[model samples]
Each structure stands twice: as C-alpha cells, then as structure tokens.
Target: MSLKRRSFLKGAAGGGAALATAAVVSAPAQARPNKVMPPQAVGLLYDSTLCVGCKACVAGCKEANDLPVDVSTPDALWDTPLDIGPKTFNVIKVYAEGTADTKDQEKNGFAFIKKSCMHCVDPSCVSVCPVTAMTKHPQTGIVEYNADACIGCRYCVASCPFGVPQSEFDTPTPKIMKCEMCKHRQAEGKIPMCAEVCPTGATIFGPIPALTEEINRRKAMKAGEANVFERRVIGSGDTHERPAAKYLDHVYGEKEVAGTQFRHMSAVSFTKLGYPELREQSYSSQSEGIQHSLYQGMIAPVVVLGGLVWAAKRASHIEDEHPEE
Candidate 1:
C-alpha cells in the first residue's frame, strides 16, 4: 500500500479497535444491578379502600404547595383537574364500573385512586435527568425537583413509569411539577398535607418499615371486619375505626420497579385503579447499566477520540513526507 493510503487505513483500524475495546469493557458494567431503597426512607401508604374521594387531600396539597388552579374544562370555574399536572400535584382519579353502586367493589361499583409521584426507590426520573434537577433524598427517599437546576427538558416526564413529573406548558418560564411528599412540612415538624388532611387514613405517611408492617397487618385482615387504622402518620396516636374492605392480594409499588417509597393498597385490582403494571426490576437498572458500561469513567470516548487524533496525526505526517502529492 502507498504510504498515505497505509496511514489512513492505520487510523481507521486504530479507531475501530478502540471502539471494539470500549464495547467489550462496557458490556459487563451495563449488567450492574439496580439500586435499593434507603434504610430510613419515609413515604406514603395510600389505602384505596379507606378513601372517600372527598378531595380534601387535593385541596390541602394545593394550599401547601401554593400551586395555582387547574381549570380542566372551559366552563368549569373550579380547579378541578382530571389528573396530576403542573397545577395539580395530587389528584383523585375515579374508576367506575356498571351501575357504580358500591365503593371499592370492582363490578358495578366506583373506586377512587390517588395519582402522584411514586417516589421510586430507584427513580427513572433521577436516573434520566442530564442535569441534577431530579434528586432523591438519602434519608427520606423523597424524589424532589429543583427548577433552578432544570433546563426545561422533559426527560423526567418521559422516564417516569407512573407518569408523575409534569411540565408546565402554559407558562413562559415552565417548570416540572410533582409531589415531594411534603418534605417541607416535615422539616417544620409537620406531616404531608395530603396525609394530614386525610380523614379516613387513606393516605398515611411514615417510615417505610412501619408502613410495611401496617401493610402486612391490613393485608391479613379479614374482609368486612372492623379494624382500627392509624391516621395521618404512624405512631401519631391518632386512630380511626372502620370496616376493612376485601383487599387484593397484591400491594402496588411494594416490589414494582424495585419498589417505591409511596406504597398502595386497594380492594380492587391495581390495574382497575389506573396503575400501570410494572415489573419488579427498575428500568434505571438496565439504562444505567448500559450508561455506566459505556461511560463509567469517560474512558471509552476518550480512548476513541485519542485513536482518531493519532490516526489524523499519522495521516498529516504522511502528507508532509510526500510534499503534497
């Protein structure tokens, strides 16, 4: 081969080799495991059977977060949102069957389900965010959004399996909005507004351990049996008496997506309550594995770039030797 031609070929070979090496090195790293929830994580336990669809939690959320009204309909003068949006951080969605005669019954009944962030143990929003806009607290396990750090990218919105994070499209300076589990209130020795205002203990906030225990207790309860559930927060010394509805054998968010800080329980199947059926493993685990494998230490790109530079330099040297043939 001619010297110039050889130089070009050498460069191409080097670049290809570098890329191949990078792929080989990254493959195993991409198989890395997903993250687990923090030991002291705090979150909400939403019992659909206990909910009365009063929307007190919705109003409290708006008031606590200082969020504006979401007028869903043109003629509607109230802040009645159809779902969780920028203006409506927490919403009560209804699932009605034929007749809608009874509450919590799947057939011929209507049921209420709360919609908000799941606050995933391994959050896809936090994983996908290019900027540090979405973050999870180590102690509380609350997924939070920082508007100042956000670049208005809807990566979080697209990544969330629960469809929690919502971007503000109406305003000029748009921000992604979602529930933070009232961490601000907790900082001030108060509970989340949604939990605080929940009269039926539908939405209870507490440490994950305690909540898990409560979930187990409730799950074991006989249907139609009277049970006393703690209201607002666990260990808050507040209790309420009510008859337990027949609970589905599963708990939403318990193991789904490696689990979520916010757990859910219901009489009807979670699918009927508008929950997306998700695998126990997290998507972040797979995505991050690929990402880390390829760019763990920025080694792959640097190696590839270095190989390209070396090739170009060799090609230039060959041209200089040939004197511009």
Candidate 2:
C-alpha cells in the first residue's frame, strides 16, 4: 500500500495498456511482401554444363576488382585460391561423385559450380545492415558495398543466404568483400570480366529479361543437342557451338528468397553444388515486417520510455515525502 508500490503498479499497468494499444493498431499488419526485381535489372546466367573447369573467370574477377592475389600454394608462383575470400571474389568449385568420369552426371561424374554473390532482389545484407554501406542499385539491382560507410559490423556477412560476403579479419581496417557484378565495367558499356573471359560461355551477363529468355531457350533444348551458346553478353555476335548437357528441371534463383539477379542452371542438382534450398519469401521481408509492426511511428518505444520516467520521478517524490519508508 506504499506510494512507491502503488506508483510502480500504475506504471506497469500503463505500459501494458500502451503496448496493447500498439498491438491493436498493428493487428492488420502482414509481413512485407518480397521486393520485385528492378526495372532494368542486370544479372548473370551461369550454366555449369558449359563450364570447362577453367579459372579464367576467377582471374578476371580479381583483376577487374583490383584485389590482391590469394597465393595458397607453398611455391607462391601462381594465384591459387581454393575458395572465395577477401582477396578473391569469384571461385569455381567442383563436385565429384565416384570416379568422376562423366561431367554433369550425379553418379560417377564431376561438375563445376561458380561461386559469388547472388545479388538478391531482396538482399538480406542490405536489409540487415545498420549502416547504409550495403545497397542494392535501383536500376541495376547490383548489391554494392561502400567501405567508407561500413562500421565493420559484419551483419551483411551473416545475413547473406549464399554466404557470399566475406570479411577481411586479418587487416587492421577490414572490409566486407563480395562480387558487385563488375558494375564499373558495366558503366563503360562492357560486361563483367568473368563473362568476358569465359571461353565456354558458362557465365554470361545481361539484362534480367534477356537472361530469362536465354534460360528458357536452353531449358527447351533437347539433351545432347548441338547448340550455339552466346558468350559474354546477350545479343553479342560472339558465340560458340557446343552440345548441351541434360539440364535439371529447376532454375535456381528464380524464386529462392523472392529471386536473385544471378541465375544458375546445371545438370547437377543445386544442393549437390552447395546451394541451400530457400523459401520464396525473403527473410528480410518477414523480419522487417515484424519490426515495423512493433515500432511503427516509434510510438511504442516512446510510450514505454515515458512510463519508466514517470515511475522513476514518482519514486523520488515518495522517498522525499517519507524519509524512513
């Protein structure tokens, strides 16, 4: 029955009421819908069947990005990176089964997969970043990182579904590194270095719509049929003739996490190629929706803070009124 106790009870009730009101106000809320692809979205189409295990794309990526050579070999004579790292933005990973005699076969075959940023339409990195260092270009949909704006939180590294973002932990001033799809080259009317140097047309860069069309074209082809695959960019005169491998029914990144700019088609199952199966809805969309519902207009937090302040002031007044109490 003390004044302090009564005041505490009132404050608690008021805070609860405020929270209830906020929840009621937000009752109609739904998780934010996944973002759509940008109007002029550009991306890459990677065909594992066409890749010849050549590391030309890897070298091109490093050279285009001005990254340091990752020399893992003891001899250090060549730039040999086993995986994508701070110094290496692109890498070719191989998956082999049994004797690996046949390429792109699940049994007794080996397959190559290119690893890099997926450049999601609704990127979790851009969503989770406290700072605006991680951004998705409105027109190009290229997920870009700004070192100056980065506080080295590594939120992007953790939020990425594709595990593309890498943090440079060894350096004093570390940076989050990932492929930006060679936006700098695109600005100059050039394609990404990886696509430019790919001899087999495994990786080609172009607008999303065009890429989709090409993907459809490839998907419609009969297995082992001789075909002409365009190299570098879509509609480019550069091309080569080759036989098509049997492609899987699925096209990766089409709906995973509400779609990504980079599309992958392979004869080997994506799961076997180290791709995680993701939902159509992006994690960011759900997280952001809950956040918005709870903290909409910042009303809930302000009300809670005010209730605490009122309780504290009341306690101070009660102490002054009854010195022994």
Candidate 3:
C-alpha cells in the first residue's frame, strides 16, 4: 500500500526493496556555492548531538551583545526566555517526546537546537531594504541593520526567510533586533560569543572548509563511538571526549538559504526543534536575482517614466486648446 510522508506505514521507508538500494535512490543533500568570504570573518558549526542543552551559549550571546533579558516571568530573577525575540538574539529551545532520552533518534529522542539569524548567503532583509538599512558586509557576509535609516516599515522582519528580526513592541521608540555576528568583537579578533562560551564544544567557530571536515569526521563514526569534541573554536585546545549520539544524517543550514554562514548538524529530526521542511534553492537568492534582472541600472524604469511625463504634458496642452470642448 502507498503511504503518506509522515507515516512509517507502507511507502518510501517501508517499500519492499533492499534498504541499501532505497537509500541510494533517496534524494541527495543540496549543493552549495563556492562563494568566498574574507580571511578572518568567522562562523560556527553546531552538532546537536554534542549539545547538552545547558543554555550557556544563549547566556553568552546576551552578555557579548550587552542585550537585556527577555523575561517570561516578571516575578523570577533569572531572566530566561522561551524563544528568540526582540530582546533576545539567540536562544536554546528544547524538544521532547515520550521518555525523550535518546539524543537524535526520532521515536522518543529529545534534542536541543540553537536559533538565531541565519546570516543568509542572499539575505531577504538586504534585498528589501529601501534605504540600504539592512546590508551584507562584503568581507564577512554578515547582515547588519541600521535603525537610523529605517522607517519602521518592518520590511526586513517580514522578508527574512528565517524570521530572525523582531521589533521591540513594548517600547515607544522601537527598533528591529537581530544578530550581526558580533562584528564589533570580530574587529577585535574575537569570535562569536556563543561559540566562545560553549562548554561542550558542540559549537565550533572557523571557515566553512574546516567546519565541513569536522562534520565529516563525526558522520564517519558509528553511534556510541568515542570522539573528542571541540568546544568554542577549533585548534583552541578546549575539547572533551564523549560517546557520539546517533546523528540523523542531516545538516540543517549547510544548504538552507543557499548555505548559511552558521551551519548546523543534529542527531534529532530538525522538526523537533521547529526547523521547517525546506526547498534546496533559497527563496531570498531567487527573489533578488529576479529583481536585479528586471531593474538593472534603473534604465528601463527611467524610459517608462519619461514616456509617462510626455503623455501627461501633451494631454494638458490639448485640454487648454479646446477648453469648451
């Protein structure tokens, strides 16, 4: 019998073919671009299996950005937010199932996922900014927003495919909030704070090339195998050895948004922590290409505007010549 996607009843996974054969025919991971960044601009690769869900990265991000806490309970002293929002640029959210003991397994496994600005390869926020308020740095590809140039239109908030930017709704003079990859600290030769303070080495900072190698090493191992996980940045000597959680054979942001600067690997199905089932081609990149092709140098629009002005003037002159008619 044919089975639906969410069910394990009868179709794809349960088809009567050899398991090896079916795996070979299953879809391949999306291809990413060879677009280059500067020598020093840094990013992170997070393995969900390595994370202990300690919330240290979230706290570190808040401290690094000098941002205030988004409190869920006014009566509580420790300001823990349930999700990313205007006051919180990063958050560690949890997903649970029955018993929730296994790390990456789908049936009853629980896992932690870190959420923040994806820093998209082709950012929708950058494309839709009317005044260049949201911009991609040439070297780092970090999307930064300037509030001075924004008209509070929330174009960026709406256009971002990852829904990263959030407006401060409670304040009178509100501003959109999001991660800028800690560029200010990066200028001082510091890595991103979350990566800096991650104790488990679940989050490591470096170029995409090096990060991919690290991820490959993990994928090569069998479940329950011992591996030394690096915390913070690679080559930093901060590491710990632990038995590997069963990886889900998927990397979250490796190809999402045409490859996010910050990549993710996890043991659990991403949907557990709210990752959307995705299209490989980035909507932001597609949207920008279409817009640029149509409006190159504004030459076409100028010619259309000139024709419109000439028609309006001619109509006015004809009306003056025969006022009565």
Candidate 4:
C-alpha cells in the first residue's frame, strides 16, 4: 500500500474499533428473547399434488385485495400474468417435464405450484422496512403492509428472498403488496380470500401448530390413501374428499429461510416449482448484529471528531512556527 493509504488505514483502525465498542456498550441490556409461536398463526398450506392450476385462488386474491388486472398480451384484455407482479399478488406456476403425463411426478409429469408470500416467521421484509410500513402482527403472526406509512423505498421488495413483495411502478403514489392472511377477513372470523374460494382445498390456512400436525399426518400416509383435507381455514368448518399423492418425503417451508408461517407440502420438488433454496440463518440476524456492533448511537463518532479537531489544531500550530511566506 502507498504511504498515505497506510497512514489513513492506521488512523481509521482506532476510530472503527472505538465506534464498535461504543455501539455494543450502548445497546439495551433488556432485549427480550424471541418467543416461540404456537401452531396458530394463520397461513397457507398448499398441497401441490391436489392443485389443478385452475387459477381460482389468483382471481379471488385480486378481487379481494383490490389489485388491478394484469394484461400480459397487448391484444388480450383479461388479466393473466405469467408470474407474480404488483397487480397480481398470487400466482400458480407450472412445472412441465418430458411428456408431462402424470401429475406431481418429477419425470415425464406436470405439477402446478402456488407462488405468493411465504409469510416468513423471520421475514426479511419486515426487518428491513425503514418506516415500519411492513410489520408482523404479534399475535396472529401475519405480516401486513400499510401503504400510508410507506415512503415508496421498496426495500421490502428487494430484501425478500422469495420475491413476494412487489412495487407499483405504474403509479406515482405506489405501495408494496403481498399476502397478509386477510387480516380484515380474520377480524370477522372469516378465512383468507384465496383459501375461502379455493376449490381444491389445496391452499388451506390454519395456525402453524395445527397445520404442521396435519402435514406430518399426510406425509406418513401412502399414495392413493383416502384423506379428507379442509379447505379455507383448517377447522373453519369446511372439508373435501381426496386421495394423497406420493410426496417426496419433505415439506418446503418447514425449514427453508428460517421457517415460514406459510408451509408447503409438495409431491414434486420445491426447486421444480420455482421455490429457491435459501439458508436457514436469517439475513436479518446477521445484518442487525453487524450494524449494532459498528454504530450504536454516535458515541464513537463524537470521539473521532475530537481526535480530528486535535490533529487540525496541532497542524496549525506547526505551520505558525514554520512561517511559510
């Protein structure tokens, strides 16, 4: 390194160290430990094996949420987005292979996948929202967005690993939109709009604990076994008759991305259905630790200013003694 570069690095080393120390020292000592959520957080349990890809959930979601129609083709007036967008909150993506004959089979088969907010237990969108516009409900565990509080920063959209949040680029006063488990409907003891209208009982909603148990029970069953799955919210007083397909012995959201409130059970692999493999260690935990350690409350900053002020004064005194014409 050059001489000036070396000198600057040496000076910054002390400043950085001091800043880190101050931040950590100032952090609240009474920080509470994270609470474990019961199986009761209302969420979606999409069984890919049962889905027929009718797109009823998508249409219902747009109508319930009041989102605009997505016209992919210039000639087409009907809304049919190939993927999720600002106007389309929920979508059903298709995974076709070979001849695409069988349903929920990895080879020479076709499977339909639901795409929307996973509603993560440790949601990065909620953690990174600068204005707290995106927040997680303490009791319900539902992640909701308030457009009035939003500054149109779109940080929630960028931070989400599942790409659930989308910004309204077509409007000047745009807002972020994603799944909220239909908080408004929940207040009336009604289930989410998507689940209420789902014909297949594929997208069932329930508390995390109850849903997990149901998922496990299904996983233990053999293919073609008779099972009655509930549509809309589990125990919302609705049931459907169906046979279980041979699952891949895995649950998609059980452990992915630090576990999501919205769990998924699929006969086909999650990768085939467009779900990205994500690390268990939440990005928020790492980011918060780094920021807290580096700059807590401007304590180190004041010390650095003091040092700079002293250096400038000493240099001025040296210049007076030298008296350069």
Model 2 bad stretches (over 4 Å): 1-29, 307-325
lDDT of 3 by residue, 153-264 (tens): 8888898767799999999888889998888888898989988888888778887678878888888888888878887787788878889876767788777656677878
Best by TM-score: 2
**What's the lDDT for all of these models?**
0.89, 0.90, 0.75, 0.79
User: What TM-score does structure 3 among the candidates reach?
Assistant: 0.78
* Model 1 regions lying over 4 Å from their true place: 1-26, 302-325
Residue runs of model 3 more than 4 Å from their true location after superposition = 1-41, 74-76, 296-325
Error of 3 at 254 (Å): 1.2
Candidate 1 residue-wise lDDT, 14-108, digit = tens: 77876777667554664457688787899899999999999999999999999988887889799889999889889999999999999988899
What's the TM for model 2?
0.88
Candidate 2 vs candidate 3: the lDDT winner is: 2
Off by over 4 Å in 4: 1-35, 38-40, 304-325
Every model's TM-score: 0.87, 0.88, 0.78, 0.85
Give the Å error, residue 284, model 1.
1.4
Q: Per-prediction count of colliding residue pairs?
A: 1, 0, 3, 5
**lDDT comparison, 3 vs 4, better candidate:** 4
Which is the winner by lDDT between candidate 2 and candidate 4? 2
- Pairs of residues clashing in candidate 1: 30-289
